[model samples]
Target chain A: MKDKFGLQRIRLSVQILYTILTNGYVYGYMQGKIYKGGLKYACVPGLNCYSCPGATFSCPLGALQSALNQRQIQVPFAVLGFFFLFGSIFGRFVCGWLCPFGLFQDLLHRIPLFQKRKQLPGHRMLKYGKYLVLAGLVLVGSSFLFDGFVKVPAFCKYLCPSGTLMGALPLLSVNEQLRSQVGGLFGWKLGLLLVLVGLSVKVYRPFCQYLCPLGAIYGWFNRFSLVQIHWEQEACISCGACQKACPVDLKPEQISVSTECMKCGKCMTACPVQCLHWRKIEKN
Target chain B: MSFWHKTLDKRPKRGMWFLLFGIGVVCLVIGIYEGQLEDVYRKAVMICLECIGIG
Candidate 1:
């Protein structure tokens, strides 16, 4: 009973934290004061978009795409630096807390009609799917290697629901010329989006769990990344409370901060022995 | 509704394959309607790029 109570509190706390990150801070930046000059700094953390109807800063993905596609290859100094800095410092914390699209999926899954299931043990191999997407789609498909400097943002083109929902749809809806020009490719993407939305309703974070290159990149740092989750194995009795508490269905004590674990800190609160703790492994 | 039945079922895989086949059929139909395969390729690129913001 006490454990369940603690789990509820932790879940509530997570909801509160997510609300602040998604709707409060990021939203404030989106709708806040207008700048005097041209545009503000190009990059900010947590996937908030500069072009978003309510966004304050530029989206990292969009910035990276534009930089790569530029004529001079000016090195995307600010964009690459921001990605490296944030990715190394906090790892997958951005996915857990700030991404507006992640928040959308969370809310959709919370609807009573959506069923939740944990694909465990044998299904672990599926986690490698995202790595392939990063390698095959983003690096290879986007390259256009034979054509010299022609790079496609393959992930955004084919897979990203966020790009569809936040970037393309909003911008396209207002532009009548674009609306008149929709073709088979748009139909394909719309089809893909529908499939992904259905998958998210059925499975938890279907995109992040399967094909988010950014998630795959940060997850690589789950071990050596500056942010770390440590377990006192000696203190732990394998009570399984942490596992029960995990939203992503991770076994936190066994593999805290695993690529699948979002590092949301729920398991920390669920630990009865207080064996699980977070440590800042590297300073930004 | 049984746990084993749910996990072991090939429903998701079958559904995935069916969706792919359906998409292929749609592509072929679109090609036929347009009277060529070339326009289909351009259409695909335009659509994909539209989603990615170039279009």
Candidate 2:
């Protein structure tokens, strides 16, 4: 139990440290300005809003959508490369440990007021929603949709609660010029953010499970990523403790490399016999 | 098992990951050459009204 507690503390520490490092532009927040620096050329491997005042790196999802929204309609090679690089190395581990929005959801879930549920109703079907968000909104919508002369980053514009909470709220609070421009769209986004916040208090990572396109992209690489959770079948007792411990309620033994597995190491700590362990791909 | 069978085992190999990583690096280089990094920087430095749900 002490080991489990220590592991969770380590994960939380990493999450906090990563968040602070990525969003290190303290002056931006003070001055209500985005960071204009060389670091913005590279994308971060998390769902942090690029518009957030403190964010020093570009968001991969926002960059991909922006690239796709160009009038010439070309493949976003840089964003794809970023995804490939991060996805191949860390996979959905980014979602589990690096994403600022994910950390926000985790903190919200820790609020003791609500009765926590491991899985939402219709979790099996709902889990596929993130993929749809990636395909239909980020990919297709950005590639084609135009609002008059301007192209829309459909997911970021319409659905990203992270943008509303982290980018919109903070910027608006500090910038009087921005506050004057607040309209129905901001209200709608705030409402959506509230719903997600309420849901997060009861359910674990509602955005990650059903809506985050970035999570969807990283999830595809989980099975093939260098970092992986290996299950030793021979040493297994069919004890269901790991499943109970899983934040997403995944059966770790049955599908060790399931795309849904975020590599959070909860199950590793939960296993009584220590059958599950983190392993890198073997050199042939 | 034959060499092919051994190579094609279910377990993920480091070689495959390295190849993918190489491909990612190549893609990143191509993108930088094409000025996509500048585009990313330009977009990131600006306050995105759409992201903030304004206008």
Candidate 3:
């Protein structure tokens, strides 16, 4: 019997590489410094927390929003272009392979804690939540003020579990003064992180599937991205093997560069006939 | 079925993507010239209190 259900060793390696690459400042906690190197000026194409003590680069989503928030700039071409460039190149492959938060969820789901739901209830409706986050919280909220004093970036300020987990949690852990400063806001953020973590054990990256606006941004470019998965329709037997293999339960053929797919290559690995292949561009 | 095929077949040329990439490079350079890189460095060094909703 073939070891068809074997562990994804290469995928794990890729995930770890990105996690360390994005957050490589090992002395940040000991020295109490966020490294302000030239690399810090660039946007990492993943949902890494910008304020993570060890983070060497700013997160693309956070940098984009921060650039927009500056009233002085009419257009933040550097941040915008980085987003466009990465999106057109890799699409949601970053979510599947690079995002530290996605890796965290993948690890959490590996635990034999409980039987997991392969799909969410009202998932079609829930999928829209990330776009809502992109529009209402990240974009509109950052560009405008909620009240006279309050800053409006609702997703990062109120909802981003990655920011809470990687940023606030680490800061609070090392600094006694920071812990003392923690109040209702800290508790609320912690609660959100807990809920998302809990759901991830069952739902295979609930945050990416539902709430990550960064993933949403990348998903938009998945269809036309340089890196794409193409199905050999002629070779397909329609045996539904790939469909069963999908963690998110999407059909293999339709999953090719689709918004919902993370391009994890599960279908390719699972296909009995070996139909799906990753390509830089489709050969027409 | 016909709609899916039509929409799926509509693809931009490889050269067009290369052109877009060049344009994107130009935008990135312009943004850095406009001091966005400096802004990123400034933001990176300091922990964002607002992002964590600490203050």
Candidate 4:
């Protein structure tokens, strides 16, 4: 139990530190302005809203959408490369340790407001929704859809709760002009955000499980990511402790190379025989 | 056995990971050369009304 708590504490600390480091533009928050610095050229490897007042780096999904939405219709190599780099290196470790929105969901899950639903109905089927979102909205809609003069970033415009919570609310709190302009669309997004917040209290990482294209993309690399969880079959005692410890209700051995494994390390701490451990792909 | 052969035989996944990492680096360089960095910066610096759900 002590080891489990210690690992969780370390993960939470890393998540907080990463959030602050990526969104370090203090002046932007005070003045209700987005950072226009050189750092904005790079995309952070997490689901942070670029429109957040304190954000110093760009959101990868937002950047990918914008790149595809341009009239010139060029490939988004930079964003693709960014995904490849981070995906191959960390996989969903970013979700567990770096993403601000993920941290928000984690904190919300700890609220103790209602009976936590360990598994939703059609959980396996529902997990595929994020992939569909990535394919339909983020990729196809951005590439082909247009709103008169400009192309639409469908995911950002219609579905991103992160934008509503981190970007819209914070900006509206300080910017009177922005508040005055809020209309039906903002209300729609706020409603969506509220629903997600409510769902998060009961269902762990509802957004990551069923909606986030970014999470879906990173998940694909889990099988071959440099950092991974290795289940040592030779030393195995099938105690079932790791499964109980898993917040997502995954069997650690079965999900050694699975997309659903967030690499949260809770299973590793729970293993009594210490069979499960973190292993770098490059190491022997 | 040679070092490379031994390593590959032990962990085939390592080779694949390095290949992907290399490809990522190459793509990033090409993107930079094409002024994609500037493009990203321009979009990010602006307060995207759509992202804020106000557009």
Candidate 5:
């Protein structure tokens, strides 16, 4: 059996389309569209701007972060429920396919001439970075690191390449008056973007691989998450084709969620043994 | 396939790193010199919040 799952490719394309739509909205493509009840709904599985020129719903992460910052009640409930619903059904498939930010990273990595490098050369614990980031964001945002409520959403403040590439650049281009008022925070974010872009050329997706809090949340449910990639280890001829086919460098035959696996299904497509399959688990 | 196409398609040339690095530095300098960093940050935050449905 050879790799048959083209889901990753399909997902990647869909993500790219979402990014284009979001970016286009920010860049002034569609200006005056009207929504009835003040367009404040959320995308089911991934990040898409509600205020985005063409966005139809709310952004889940933004809502969660704001709730955390404001100390709201139902916000946590909303976040938890959203995670459970998506986690049970799609698992980390959200990271692989649906996330607009993930798409941005994928596109940036496609830029030729950069040698994507591995930030984690130590033990393979690097996969935990996103979880750590999630924790850091919630903890820091709700409570000051050491002092007051000065903690910004650290992920958006420092690490999110999506914010830098999709939202920041286009918005600045259109709002020239806004561009005239730059400072240290902007400098820091630009520096971060530069590093991310450079690293993307060297690594497949440095941000997703290392720092995305959203990816971390989804990845937590990867193993038993309703949408799962299963391997019939018994049908094993360890040809390592799936291993090589993996863009995120996961050895699909061995482990599933090592932070390296984007669940892109490149392994599923490249598996000559055709042992990989996706199935839904019913809660009984 | 033509040699150029083949070359262009395989992966970026090593020197592309230096070129990107140079461009990044220039942008950094220009952005700093022009003193538009805070504006950029605020804009980034507002837009990011909007994109994700926060704003």
Candidate 6:
């Protein structure tokens, strides 16, 4: 019980810290301009909208797709390197601890108003959904699927619930100009947000599990991330408590780490013997 | 497994990490060389009107 309480506190603290760090410019909300300072050139580790009034940094995924869609095809080394550095270092640790959207989903999942469903139909198969979004929508669609006129960042334009939540909704609420511009796209995004809200109430991070391309990218690097969860196999009793406590239902005893594991430390709290611990991988 | 899945494989030694860091540094240097820092700053200063499907 003490461990669980500590974990909860830690999660709450991290959530609040990330929120403040990413959106530190509280004055920007009053000014109604995206914070365009030197901080804007940096990318936060999590999904933050560049257009958010308070955001001081650009969204890495947005920067990536935007750069990729350019006709000249210059490699966006900053964005790519930013992704490579952080993704390899922390993996989905940011998703579990820092992302505003991730925190929102966790909060929604805690409402106790909806029946929790760990697995929906085709749940196992749906694990690949994020990869598909990353490849087909973000990369290939941007590169090849222009309508012979203009290329759209299809993932952000059509799909990114974060952009809808942080960018579109906020802009429309504040700017009268944006209010008049709302059309089918806005309606579609609103519908998507509503559906996500409903799902998050019942499901654990459905968007992170099955939709976020950035999550998919970070997840890909989890195996080599500097911070790793190491289990002491010798101190083992296979009570299966870790699996029960895992937010995404990943079995802790599995040989391969599930890409879906966000390293949320819930499993560690749940472990009766306290066999799992976070470790910095060492140089041999 | 596809190439994507290979990315999740654990690196056996420090050499692999050095390679990864090397790649990151190369990219970072190229980005700086291309004046992308200035471009990114410029991009940040303006709101992307079309990004949220507003335009």
The local distance difference test score of model 1 is: 0.56
Evaluate candidate 1 and give its CAPRI docking class based on DockQ: incorrect
CAPRI-style quality class for the chain A–B interface of candidate 5: incorrect
**What's every prediction's RMSD, in angstroms?**
14.5, 3.2, 2.2, 4.2, 15.2, 3.2
Please write out the lDDT profile of model 1 over residues A1-284, one tens digit for every residue. 25534644554466556545333433323433212222333344465433333343445665555445444444444454555556656668767655666666766666667457645244577888889987876655555432344566665666666656654566466655656776766667777777877766767777777777778877755544455666666788888988887778876443434677777667777888888877655232
What is the C-alpha DockQ of each candidate? 0.04, 0.50, 0.58, 0.40, 0.02, 0.38
Candidates 1 and 2: which is better by lDDT? 2
**Tens digits of lDDT, candidate 3, A1-284:** 23264535677889999899888788875654567778888888898777888888888778777776776546778878887788778888888888999999999988888898766899989999999999988888888855465455567788888888878877777877777777898789889899988998888888999889988988887776788777777898989987787777877556745688888878878888878777776544
Sorted on lDDT, best first, the list reads 4, 2, 3, 6, 1, 5
**lDDT values for all models:** 0.56, 0.86, 0.79, 0.87, 0.55, 0.78
Chain A TM-score values for every predicted structure, listed in order: 0.78, 0.97, 0.94, 0.96, 0.82, 0.95
lDDT pick, better of 1 and 6: 6
Better of 4 and 6 by lDDT: 4
- lDDT string for model 4 (A1-284, tens) is 55854888999999999989987788888889988888899999998788999998999999999899889879888988999999989988888888999999999999979999865689989999999999999999899888898899999999999999989998999999999999999999999999999999999889988889998999988777898888776787878888888877876554446687788898889999889898887543
TM-score versus the correct structure, for each prediction: 0.68, 0.95, 0.93, 0.94, 0.71, 0.92
* TM-score between model 5 and native: 0.71
Q: Could you give the DockQ of candidate 6?
A: 0.38
CAPRI tier for the interface of model 3: medium
DockQ score for model 5, please?
0.02
Count clashes in each candidate, considering only residues at least 3 apart in sequence or on different chains: 5, 0, 0, 0, 26, 0
* A15-117 per-residue lDDT for model 2 (tens digits): 9999999887889889888888888999989987889999988999999999998989787888889999999999899988899999999999999977899
lDDT of 5 at A49: 39
What TM-score does chain B of candidate 1 reach?
A: 0.44
- Model 5 has fnat of 0.02
